[model samples]
Target: MSNTGLMIFDGEVLRSIDISLPELQHNITGAQLLEISESKVSKSLSGLTLPPNLKNAAVSQVSDGDDVTFRRTEFNQQQASEKLGVFISAVADTLRDAPVVVSVLDGSMLKMFLEDEDDFAMLAENLFTDLDEEDKGKLCKREIRNALVHMGVDMGVPPLSEFPILDDIIKKHDADGDEELGQAQFAQLLQPVLQEIADVLHEKPVTIVQNVEIFTGSRLRKILADEKTLKCLVTKTILELSNEKDSQGRADPIKTLILSNGKELGLPPLSSENEPVALLYETIFSQLNNRDKQTAADASTEDGLMDSLKDILRKFEDLLETAPVYSATNI
Candidate 1:
């Protein structure tokens, strides 16, 4: 087993950083070394030079009883960067929201959709619409099995004689236990498969910061705890940054308008210099109620900030996706 520790700042540990021997060897940059060295020797500290090996070295100390051994080893920066990129990609992929599929009917609808057959379409068009309310409430086991068969055949899954899984699926959705699956039950049975397909078709990868709900909620919680930071972030976003233009000469009018309106409504101004734009938005979101938060988030999506965020996220995703395939030898 290897011992690991975090690189801490201001007494708070940043999450997901690994400072194990291997990691430290891989991530030690020239800038980091310069920073450490400069911080140590108060005045100028110019004319100092580092060993060539130090550029690729990992610094660590191991203690045994009263004895301590310091170790240093060389590692390639290209290799390290690739590994870090891969790690980031994995984390980004995990943060993505699962895809959503519209449910047509029970799990049977999934089979019909996958097969793209006329029979399934006919059944879908007539089944519930033709049946009376009472009749539409339940579908017999035979009907479910037929739908399952249609689904299984297309997917190369053989139908079992007992169809135990089918029975369980129906039972799970058969809320009334009338030995039949109602429309709602049918929809429930198909949800998982439909959702999987939906995810594949309409997948949108997002990081934790890009996830509106988590980003907003977490920032709000933090701001609420620290009123000073909250005020600073709010003032910067609404009063200053909103009017600032990007390289393309476009302003964030939606954010500007929203923040200005918020201030007009007697909302307090929070002041801070050089705060990050993301943090500013997070503070703004934190002040909103759930409904308002959602509304503001939705509005941001339409006003181009969402696209910018997505573009940034995609760049990271692309870097991570390609990292594993990158070769240090090529560099």
Candidate 2:
């Protein structure tokens, strides 16, 4: 699975935030955390944006209705930071634990198609012709299931896998029987079956978790803006390189580092199997090679390596800004 843009509260993301230490030194209240407005907290956060769908869930987790600890509490800078960090972490946890983003199949499309007389007539005729193999005017009632499949999910019909009610719906119409049906009988069976599906969907919309890679660069941009966080990342990368004994290659270290940490930095997962991501890396690395011949040599030092990583990340950000990627997930 690809990384989700939704923030999964981590120490790294919490540390990246730049909050006013002094502002949080006063006596705190559970109702208002550190005098920080939701908007301010949101802005201070790095590498995390709370999407609208998740706002309510996050807010609900921010409080537990117990204020005994925070009432009339005065804390030092470290304590204040810790307190605020706890709250932020809770919000992130809520978002992460909540369901992945989903699309609701509420039968609106099917209703619209049914409402249009010309469209429904054409659709029925087409389905009849397709199912009537051997050019026979009649078809087995079992073909009604095929008709439903022909309509598919695009017409607001859920897959049998996603919506098991479809089987029951088909059975209710006796469409499972082998009784022969002419064009009119087939259309008659189809219309009511579709109508019933639409009614069921109207009562309980099917939520489909789309498998997609959303690369808006918002998280990446936030990470890039946090100088302290960038410095910390560089320092950690250097230590990892030293421990792994991976200093021989020029740009290879950077490439490996990025491929490993791209998801954390809000880029799509980079692997050989994912062509779009692979091509992105190829293009960026190609440019890096052409522009800086001494990149390999520069990897010997800390500052030089940091500069190279920043450059590569900036290229990714720019590219993503121009063309964001999204895909539908099958649940």
The candidate scoring highest on TM-score is 2
- How high is the lDDT of residue 178 in model 2? 86
Q: Which whole-number lDDT from 0 to 100 does residue 255 have in model 2?
A: 69
**Clashes, model 2:** 3
Top-lDDT candidate index: 2
Question: Which consecutive 10 residues in model 1 have the weakest lDDT in total?
Answer: 1-10
Alpha-carbon shift of residue 50 in model 2 (angstroms): 14
RMSD of each: 21.1, 11.5
1-331 per-residue lDDT for model 1 (tens digits): 0011111111011124342223353455434433433233211111112222221221211111111221222226554444333332332233222111111122232344545555434544344334434665567534544454554423322244422344544455443233565665554444443334324323321101011111112222333355454344445544454456562564443445445543332222333432333344454344443335455455343334333323323333333233211111111
Write one digit per residue (lDDT tens) for candidate 2, span 14-49: 444554555543555544553463544455443123
